[model samples]
Target: MATLILVRHGRSTANTSGVLAGRTPGVLLDERGAAQAAELPARLAGLPIAAAVSSPLERCRETLRPLLDARPGLALHTDERISECDYGDWSGRKLAELTEDPLMEVVQQHPSAAAFPGGESMPAMQRRAVEAVREWNARVEAEHGPDAVFVMCSHGDIIKSVVADALGMHLDLFQRISVEPCSLTAIRYTRLRPFLMRLGETGDFGSLAPRPAKESGADDGRAVVGGGAGAP
Candidate 1:
């Protein structure tokens, strides 16, 4: 069996502004996100993280700052397969504005195969996301032996795909599971089956995590949903 740690990116400008940001370039993490990133290392203190993998996106890379700062010796492996689903024309658009698009209709009725006007199909996204983690798990077990601990930094949808896969839920139900940003999830797997050790648990992988400050209103760092790995 292998122990795996999954982390979603920190809060981005897109996140705070309520934009979809699917495969959008240079969206980057904001100041609060940088602060949030710094807190991760402490949360992961004492944990033996053997390998770190990340999605091939700017947001995902910025999320790696905390984990990398905590473990500079760890090399980051970039995986395109772990990237957020391409939102195509909808990329960088606000959610409320997107609600009226015809694309959402397809997503509502046939989520698994729902393809945005120019976005990726849900089924394809789910398959690749699941494969990204499974492939990494296999590699970790093979290279570092069966008990190796690995960390993965990815996007919200990708993390949901992983949880849904682990729980044997339908691909279309991705929105049902709420994985918070910067939250960490741990999955253990053997030749027989896969088990969830932690689901949408924040402050579990990186070391030296500082407590997040309180927000003015209801927008404090409280978990919004299990939409991603670790939504800190």
Candidate 2:
């Protein structure tokens, strides 16, 4: 097992404006987002991150820039699987305006059964995002060893979906998980099961330090542990 840190890209123009950017091109981080990105290097400075991966979107790429700068030797890779959900016809629409659409209710309450009119079903999104993380987890471990740590910068919904899978929760319940922009969520993978070390952490690196050993009764006797983080 290998550690995967999931990072949600910093706030973007679409975020502040209340529009669903979806796969829209040219959407970049806003001023506050840049500041958020700037602080990430220090937040993650002490971690032994071996590689950096991000969505192809500009927002994700911009969010990863500082990390790359801080770790000049880290290789940056892009994977489309972790990209934002395709909102299809709803892409670029205002969330407030979309509230009137009947599908919004399904999206809010029964996401597992909801599908964007011209886009993907929520369940399908979860499957792909979960598979991508599993695949990368294995690859990183093989390349950098079982203790390797890596960063994955992605979108809000995608990170939430991944978190839901890690927690063994169903897709419909994924809505209950909230990921903030530029936040960090850590997960540790072991041979027996995934351990959620942290969730939706922001503006602090205090918890990023190596976790304390499990107390006597808390030990599960699992080996090959890895760390994970999710940022939205």
Model number with the top lDDT: 2
So what's the TM-score on candidate 2? 0.87
Q: What are the lDDT figures for the candidates, one per model?
A: 0.75, 0.79
**Per-residue lDDT of 168-202 in model 2, one digit per residue for the tens?**
99887777776667988887788888888778779
lDDT (Cα, tens digit) per residue for candidate 1, span 1-232: 7898888888788877767888887888888677767888888888877899999888778888777977889899999888988877888777657766776756655578677668677788889988888989999889988888988998877887888898888876666566667878888987777898998776344422443433211133222221422333
| Stretch of 10 with least lDDT, candidate 2 | 222-231
TM-score of each: 0.85, 0.87
| Segments in model 2 whose C-alpha atoms lie over 4 Å from true places | 204-232
> Which candidate leads in TM-score?
2
Error of 1 at 10 (Å): 0.3
